[model samples]
Every structure is written in structure tokens, then in C-alpha cells.
Target chain A: MIDLYPTRGGDEPRFIDRQDPVVYGTAEDGPIDAGTLAGFDRDGFLTIERLIEPEEVERYRAEMRRLGRDMRGDERVVTEKGSDEVRSIFEVHRVSEVFAELVRDPRVAGRARQILGSEVYVHQSRVNYKPGFRGRDFYWHSDFETWHAEDGMPRMRAVSISIALTENHATNGGLMIMPGSHRTFVSCPGETPPDHYKHSLKDQEIGVPDEDSLTALAGKHGIELFTGPAGSATMFDCNCMHGSNGNITPFPRSNVFIVFNSVENACAEPFAAPSRRPEFIASRDFTPVL
Target chain B: MIDLYPTRGGDEPRFIDRQDPVVYGTAEDGPIDAGTLAGFDRDGFLTIERLIEPEEVERYRAEMRRLGRDMRGDERVVTEKGSDEVRSIFEVHRVSEVFAELVRDPRVAGRARQILGSEVYVHQSRVNYKPGFRGRDFYWHSDFETWHAEDGMPRMRAVSISIALTENHATNGGLMIMPGSHRTFVSCPGETPPDHYKHSLKDQEIGVPDEDSLTALAGKHGIELFTGPAGSATMFDCNCMHGSNGNITPFPRSNVFIVFNSVENACAEPFAAPSRRPEFIASRDFTPVL
Candidate 1:
């Protein structure tokens, strides 16, 4: 299994050789292969080296930035800037073919299918761009709060993918993940009463650490920051605890996040409420595939 | 809003007012108007009196018993006689014309549409039969877990409907609900670990409550215990806390449950990954209707 954390000094990210192409051809074979999937089942998240060609990553980044600039003028974009500390171009998946192409990419889809085992569908998609020195880091939280309200057996969707269009380094403030945090289901404050649920990790308790300190803690428990060049991507279970620091680099940190789910796991309606756009409603259908 | 709990102790179980055809009609001034949706939302759950005629309910009950008997010999049916305390026949919506008619019932469908505010689709249908003296009571819990996951927000589906095929009363274990429970989210313990995502009523601890105590709690919180003769139906929010007590009477308690979700909020997959179903796959454009 790919060790989630490498030795302290060797913290620099290294690329692993791609596995042989399977029934569904994609670089996903490296991260979601039999071995990787088994590891993810136990570990909750996995990062693949060079899942996309470096050039392809560069192209996606350039195209996304252009789309983001164009969307700024579109009236449909509802900017919730300070709330999340990041500027997002909402509903780009509906208007931009580039965004649609990334979501429908066969490589990503194949990995999702293999992981979920059931027919899956696109629940939603978004593009987030973090301008350097412009925002506070996002709070650490799980993504399943709105969807799974009824308590029963645990259900999981495949890891949501965040493709780094820009090099995510210490200066650019890449994503940091808590290893084994998926096992810690922290009740979201305010969303539900604290007495009703228990939270293992609190936003106030997560102290920001330098690269050296991060590597040290990560080495001890296999926790690590997802810092790599522009072409790399990180795939994490939706339930895993993850958040990133603010970008302090010279350039803006941008990425395209495409979240997918298994078809058998139908989402609640309020979770996928339609955008105000008539076109979005015209094309979007909420029926479960299976 | 029709008050779920009338201060008067003798308020009889209200059946759908079929004689006032407007309430049951398709006209703008229908008896069961979608505008009544606001009332249903405030009340948490509502019963449409006489949703099915008494004769039809008898026929359905008889048919279910036959199906249960036939299943005793079928390998696919997993339980033995007497061992089958609570037998649920699945996918009746796809197999039974009666279910189809009920799903399309405008009086029911229109109200569901307004509450969910989306084009709704029948997610699944089942017949639950609780045999007299041999039936097991279900624990208090919410319904959202089976239909959706935690991540997808704004809940796609709004409510679930249980149509009574036999008289439901204290002796036969009618449904019991915790009022105002839907407003708050509680985490329950799951099979994997204590922290696994589970939702329940916050004010009450998890354990089986005696019938008298359970009924009293419902009454205290303005909760409602739905008791009625054959042909009545109760509709409740997916997140509401509810369950039934064992039948103490001589007769079996039987009901047909038809769950629907707004088509716009319908998901191709249920959210949250339970450890039991570890399989995950990427979603595809497999929604039957879209």
C-alpha cells in the first residue's frame, strides 16, 4: 500500500509508476487499484502521483482561469465570498463546457465507478479560486452533513477529487488532512445541538503548523499535507476531515473540484436544490439511476 | 395548518374527506390542496383520512397475507413462519397497480410536491405486516439515512407516507412520533464505531420506551401517535423521529409505505457510506427519467 506519510526528510512528493491499464483506462489505476482501494477503505483517503499528465493539468488550469474571469460578468453567479473565505464561480458546470468536460472525464468516472461499485451520478460540481493573502483558511468539516440525516449504517460515496491547476506548495497553502480523522465524526456546531452529537476535532483546536512540523506529525501517524506540482490531484472520502491554509504565495491557488456519488445513494432534495437558472433546471434531472 | 394534536381528547382520527370531492378532485379548489402543504410542514406529519376505501384495504391485507404465505416456500424469502415478525415486501410500487394508483393519487401527490417543492418520484414502496403478539417494535430513528447520505444538502426528499391497510391503535401498535425532533439533528451510534454518523432525537436518550411512557412523551412534546382504522394514511418528514410498539391486541398491524422524493431533488445514489456496503463507484448519467 502507498504509505500515506513517507519518512520525514523524504517528505518531498514523488511520482509512482502507473499501473497497467485495466478495463477502464485512466491514470486512476494508480490510486484506485485493488491495493489502493483496500488502503483507502482502511485509511479514508489516497493521493496518486501524476494522475494527469503535467501538460493536461496545465491546460485545465488555464482554461478554468479563463472561465472564472468570464463568469465574473455573468449575472447568475452568486458570490458568497467571505463566508467560506474563497471566491467561487457558481453553476459553471452548467454554462462552461470546460467544466462539464472535467466532470464527465472518463478517467475520473471510471475510478468513481470502481470505488462506489454501483452506478454513480454527478451530485454537483464547483470551481474554487483562492486569491493569495485574500482569505482565512476554511474550517475543517465533513461533507455529508446535509445529505445523511437519518442515522443507520454508514454509507460512503467515492473520494471527491480536487485537481490542482496551480502548484500547491507551502507558500500556496495546499490542503492538509487529518489521518484517521474519518473515524472521528465531529458533530457540526450550530448545524446540530452539541448535546445531540459529539465532535472529536474542533476548528479552534486545529493549530496551523509549518512544513517541517507538519511533516513530523504526519510521519508519526501517517498524516500529511497534499502539496505537489500543478498536475497532481488528491482523492479523499467525503467523510474524511480535510481543510487547507490560506494562499500566501505570489499567485492565486485555483482548482476544479468535481464531487460524484454512487447511483444507489440517492441524495435528499434540499441537498441538490436547483439553481435559479432556467437552463440548469432544463438539463438537470434528479432521479436515481438504479 | 391542521393541528396534529387537538386539545380535545375525543378528536376522532380524521379520514380523507372523500365526500367533499373538491378535496380529492384535480380542480384548483381541490379538497387536499397543495396550499395545505404549509400546514403539513408545521405539523411534521399529517394523516389523510380514508386515503383508501375500507374494502380496498381489506383486499390489500388479504393479498399481502397470501404473498407472505407463498414466500414461505420461496427461497428468496429469507424468514420462517413465526420468525417473520415484521415482514416487508419490497418494490411494491413497481409490481402492484394499487401502489401505482396510490403514488399518482393527486390528493397525496400534490401536497407532497408542495412540501418538497420539486417534481417528485416514487423512490420505493413496501408492505409492512406486524403480526399480533409476535411482532417486534422498531426503535426510534429518522428515515433520511436509508434514502440519502450526509454530504448532499438542502435534503432532496421531503416526506414519507405510510398507508394503513388495517386498523392501527394502541392494541395493534400504531405509529409514534416525536414532535419538533425534525428541527434538530442528532447523531446516533452506528455499527462500525461509536462515532459513525447516526441521527436521532436529541432530548431523549437511545433505548426502547414502554408504550405508556412513549405515548406520554409524544403527548408532552406535542408529538402525535397516529391511530386509525383501515384506509387511513400518515405522511411525515424523512428526518422526523418515529417508531412503533409491539401489538398487544389479537389482530396484526399492517401498512403499505410509499416513499417519494421531488424529481428535482432525486439523487442517483443514497449518500453516506455505511461500512457494511463498502463498495463505492463513480456516478453516471443513469437517472431513469433525466
Candidate 2:
């Protein structure tokens, strides 16, 4: 049986210690990092804290945010309706030096290569800033919902890395996740009743009570809250149960969400959000920003 | 601006009417229907009510449940750790006539075709039976979290269809959806604090008023609960915000969720699920079950 972190309440939540810096430059010869890969296979989520230097984090955060704001204001960009409030910045690898550097970060990409077991490619990139007071709190959901097979392939693979610019904690509405929730794929919920809090589905229910119950259950199940200082990052399975509460902190909670996938698995289409034009791939000879 | 139906609290969500039924009669015409296509684009989801007959629903549900029970007994079919639940019954799709029929349902295929605007194929098929009080509730989240692209194509195209065999209602625990929530791709919230609910990312302090607060914000934005009669189903954009409440009812809330995509946009490799085998194809000619 795989060893897992004991649940706070009785639940067997999967947890792995953040990757150690000493192992950052470890040789990749035989058998991928067993511990990290096993943790990922079991928990469907893993974290490599301080994947990048503090200086690089600050640079990427500042420049990306600026670029994000600029793209959001561009009128030529036909923002999809209903998406006006939320900024959808794309293809930063081309425009931002910071992004370019980070995408090729050896530490990040190397680990990704080991885990993915394929030739990785930058599938898509974006920066989302949920501004305080006015920022939106994303509901609970998964990421695999949009992908479909085109060339007869059956499965899709993706890895998402989020770099926190601001400290992520309960006060700031850091992420709240359910342990081992990725094991199942649940159908999307439809509308809710007036007393939505009292609302329940055939399989489950959600409200203050349900939330509290799940929270308690999560604790009992060993689900852990991922809190970290700015520059620290966490990587979890795309199917993992994760979402953040509203950022109740005075400052904005900002993060750069970078998603990568095997080139064979990602689409060749241009970034769908800000632009319909395909993203440019650096020639094989060109050096990656990293 | 897109025309929207007049909505009332507790009333069934409205659907844009189509002059023609989205149907597929030929292989060359593609799979998804126009109505399904248009609905998915506008609402981020659509449903082909009664795509399968009642008898089919019953047949598939009973057989799959029996198979699942048998699998569980033999311990060959792995149940998600911590919970004695098997998420999707993909293998059943191979053996069950009902599942195979639904997977090849022209209505569904046609809609997927329209959204993807290309030839399409089935990515996976399974029975999602949220059993009695024991069933777990999936949190609000998006589908793109895990999907990756393939051979330069996007990871997904079109919508996911769930054909319900049993009545999905508040009593039985139907689906709860947040409309217009798909447009925003919010960052994954890491670990959250218990008191985080009291605070808003916009506001840093705890004890925020319940009125017009973030939780209330979702309500003001309003959530749509999908409660439909048996044989009715719903489909939505992969990015939409959705989650279900638990089965407070005594009976099992069951449905078959069949996912399809534009053949061009699916991942080169299927995401690692029980159904990830490359030979698994839901198309009629591709791999028809006797």
C-alpha cells in the first residue's frame, strides 16, 4: 500500500513533501524520480516549492501583469461576451522575456519531462489576477473538461504550474482542495434552488453546511490546505479537486498560471483567447529563454 | 447581443429554439447537431433531452450497476482509494448495448461536430451513478484543468452530454450550474483558511456581511439547478462552473456521461483514465460492439 499523509480527521489525503533544493540539479539517468512520480500517481497533485528564484518570480509577476493589463484594454481584441470581466491573456511565451525564461526553466521543465514521460511543449499560458473586493472567486471545477481528441488519440495530458506573486493563505483566500478527489470524474452541476445553501443533488449537496461538512470531511480525509509565501509554487494533477475562496485580504492575490502539455497532445491552433492567430514556435536551434 | 430567454426563480432554464433538430444521418455530414452546437456556444452547455429511450436507460443502468458490483466483488476493477466508488464505467461501454447506442447517438455526435466544426470522435463514455447519501459531490470547476492538445490541435472541441436514466431533481440531487461562469478562467485556489469565507479577495477582512457578499455574489449571479425528468439530459461548455449536491434522497441518481470532441482537437494521447486505451473508439464504424 502507498504511504500517505494521515488525514486530520480520518480521511487519507495524499501529500508529498515539497521538492528539496538539493535535488534540483540531480542527474536524470534511470527510472524517473520514484517518490515524486509515485506521489503524483497516488495523490494526483504535487508541489515543488521555490522552483524559481525570488528575483525571477518578481520579474515575471510584474512584467506579466503589465502585459495582461495591456491586453485586457486592447479594443481590437474581441473579448468573448460574458468574459469581459475576466481577463484572458494568452501566448505570453512570445511577448514576455520572463515567461520565456520560466517556460524553459530546467528545474520546472525537467521535472515535468520526468513526470509526463514525453516530449513536452508549451500548450498555453495565462496570468489571472483576481483583484481584491472586485475580483471573482472561481468555483470548484476541473481542467480536463475542454479537451477533445482530434487525430484519433483517446487521452490528453497537461501540467499546470501556478506562481504566486502574493502570499497565498486563508486570509488572502488561498486554494482549498479535497484530497484524493481526483480519483472520480463528477458531472457538472446545473442551476441551484433559491435556498441553494439547502440545495442537495442525488449524489451530493453544497451549502454552508455541506461546505463545512466537506471541510471537516476533508480534514478527516487528510486533505491539506496549500499555503505559501510569494514565489513558491504548487503543481497538482489537472483532475485534482481545487479552488480558492474569495481573497479577503487587502491586497490583490495575483498568480501566473502556466499550462504545458506534450507537443503531441496539445493543439496546434493559435491561442483561442485574446487572438485567433496561432502561436509562433521557436525554431529548434533557437535557445529557450531559460 | 445573443437573445436570452426570460428566466424565473425555480423555473426550468430556457433553451434557444432551433428550427431544425440537430440530426446526423450520414458519416460525411459530421456528428453533432446544429441546435446542440449553437446551444453549447451560447450557454456553454446544451442537452439533448430523450436522446435515449427510457428502456435503454434502464437496461444500461441495471447492467452496468451489476457489472460494477461484480467488479467490486472481484477486486479487479479498482475503486478510488478512501471511497468505495468507481468514477466512470468505460469498460461497460464495450459490453453494454445501451451505452454503445448512446455513444454513437447521432444527436450527440452531430452537436460535437458543430462545435468542433470538423469530423469528430468519441473520447470516452461511462455511467456516472451518484449513489444514495454515499455519493460524493464534485466541487465547482472547469474541464480544461487537465486536457492537453495533440498534433497541433486543441485538446477539446464541443460539449459533454449526460443522459439521465433517473429523475434529477432537488429531492434526488440534480446538477447545479453557474451560468456565464465559463467565460472566466479563475486560478486554482490552493489551500484555504476556514474563515476565508467571511473575507473576500476584494476585501481583506473577515466577517464580511452575507448580503451581496462573494457567496451572495454567486447567487446574484445566480446558479441554475438542473432538475429534469428521467430520459432528459444536459450538455454544457467544458469551462462552465458546475458541481452537484449530495444525494439526500433514498434512491440512486444515475446517468451516463458520454464525452466527444472535434476529431482534430483531441489530445494526441488520451488523459490517463481507466478508459485511456488507444483502441477505445465510440464511433459506429470505428469499433462497433455486437
Name the 10 consecutive residues with the lowest summed lDDT in model 2 chain B.
B1-10
Q: Write the per-residue lDDT of candidate 1 for residues A118-148, one digit (tens) a residue.
A: 5666655666677653433444444543233
DockQ of each: 0.01, 0.01
Relative to the true structure, how large is the alpha-carbon lDDT of every model?
0.51, 0.48
- Tens digits of per-residue lDDT, candidate 2, A50-80, equal 7667887778777866776677655222232
DockQ winner:
2
Off by over 4 Å in 2: A1-290, B1-37, B73-87, B95-97, B149-156, B189-221, B269-290
The positional error of residue A155 in candidate 2, measured at the CA in angstroms, is 61
lDDT of 2: 0.48
